[model samples]
Target: MTVYAVVNTKGGVGKTTIAVHLATMLARAGQALLIDGDPQGSAASWAAWRRDGEFSPSPTTTVLLGKAVFNEGKALSQGFDNVVVDAGGRDNGGLRSALLLAQRAVIPVGASNLDAAAMTDLLTVVELAKDYNPDLDVRVLLNRVDPRTKDTAEMLEWLAEQNLAVMDARVCERVAFRRAIGEGATVQEINKKDQAAVSEIEALFKEITQ
Candidate 1:
């Protein structure tokens, strides 16, 4: 019963995108549940779109904000192989509950100084969650990276200073991500094949799941 959560204190970091994609992939492999722990309800919205579109092998997605993410989410995990929670973009009870419930939490960091700077507050919250869930496996994932720029290297340096281990699979900025996510699909399900996006996301899925 492995539970994963994509969390970040700041908005626009692509937490829902990652969470939904991961949940989709996990559902393809086996029974999986996607909990929308955010009040924004982006994950729930994505699940609804997927339903209308009738995407094959879709995960069961439900909105479970606040402490329901901990209480109800745990109760709902029965018979599921995996659970992925999309934690909201703030210091909220939902986010903290996700931290408590998740066996692994992936924090997506964007490619900018401000994005890296925001980690201080988010990690502070994770630290507090660690007080209770001491075994939580926290991972820092680099998202929206520009392969053409020096930003990736700079962000690596900043992350090194923070002494946090970074995920090897980095998701570069690509139109495929926005297009697929907007349509309640992943790059793998899109009409046009973005091999790069597919590879990046698949690698991430493997890293966290394996």
Candidate 2:
């Protein structure tokens, strides 16, 4: 299974959004699993969104804490196309456990200096994760970006300078994203004909799976 942990030290950086969307994307493509590692259980809450009829095309998700991650590892070993873990900020034990199980670390950041600062700490955690798994593929995903601004270009350049791998896909700040999530719907299901949104998500999915 391809295990990816969505992480960030910064709050409100869209980490949970990325994790939830990516899980749906992977599930749409094929079989997958999603693990909620945050104590807040945002991911689990999202899964409940579907159970409560708040979402559509919901992906299978499990809320895991502490040693429950061990069972998650067994699931990954058995067979899964992908496993996406929604992780908490800082060096929380749950975060560390998720990192230990993940083959890749995905750090999501906003287009702001404060977001960038928080990402620095996340990078440190990525490096720490590497000590346990040398092949760990740590990458950055720019989220809530203003596609029309020069800040996007500047941010990408800045990330490169910091020696981080960044995906070509960028999620623009769109009302559709906010609306869909508020209604507990995946972008694909809510706006299947939304070409721009579809294109962005498809690009990110392709890059990660490839």
Candidate 3:
């Protein structure tokens, strides 16, 4: 019913992790598939780990890069109720391809000066792709936020001036994410006790789909 593309031109922004978590949640709610568009293959590796760990009802996944992502991502979307495409950490064919067809495009930005500054360069690319995917709903996700400061207020205000929507849901940096994804698991899967991390991911999923 929907295609979500998680993209950012800069690396270390938790792009793959966010995509995988959203895919897992979407699969639980409906028939879902994850398309790993990054050459790094991190999302694909996480899918493998989830399988190895014997997780039930995981999203079906595949790797499609370059122009194939545009050509095949749409073709693959037909068989699933939802599709989540994890684009690479650069402005490339794969990223552009996903933008061409995604219903919602999420750009995850880490809460740091450098990551915040990179938003303009990435949004420029998004603007270029907008001619092709005019209906794409773009949202900037505030990821790895520091609980103390929430430190992204200034950056978000800037994005608002550009008329971009910053998602109300934000994900704080936590060890649970690293540990869970390392084992190909979600925070809820690894520890039902870690409600914060679990809630954050769930909220993100709902926000993207809503």
Residue 35 C-alpha lDDT in model 3: 94
RMSD of each: 1.0, 2.3, 1.3
**Steric clash pairs (candidate 2):** none
Tens-place lDDT per residue, model 2, 72-175, is 65565456678888886733666777778888878888887677666676677678878887898888889889867777777778898899998878888776
For model 2, state the Cα shift of residue 182 in Å.
Answer: 2.2
**lDDT per residue (tens digit) for residues 8-106 in model 1:** 999999999899999999999999999998887889999888888878799999999799999999999987999999999753899999999999999
| Model 3, span 93-152: residue lDDT tens | 999898987989999997776876777778888999898778989999998888787468
What lDDT score is found at residue 121 in candidate 2? 66
Candidate 1 has its poorest 10 consecutive residues by lDDT at: 88-97
Model 2, residue 89: displacement in angstroms? 1.7
Q: lDDT per model, in order?
A: 0.91, 0.76, 0.88
Candidate 3 segments whose C-alpha is farther than 4 A from its true place:
none
Question: For candidate 3, what's the RMSD?
Answer: 1.3
lDDT preference between candidates 1 and 2, better one: 1
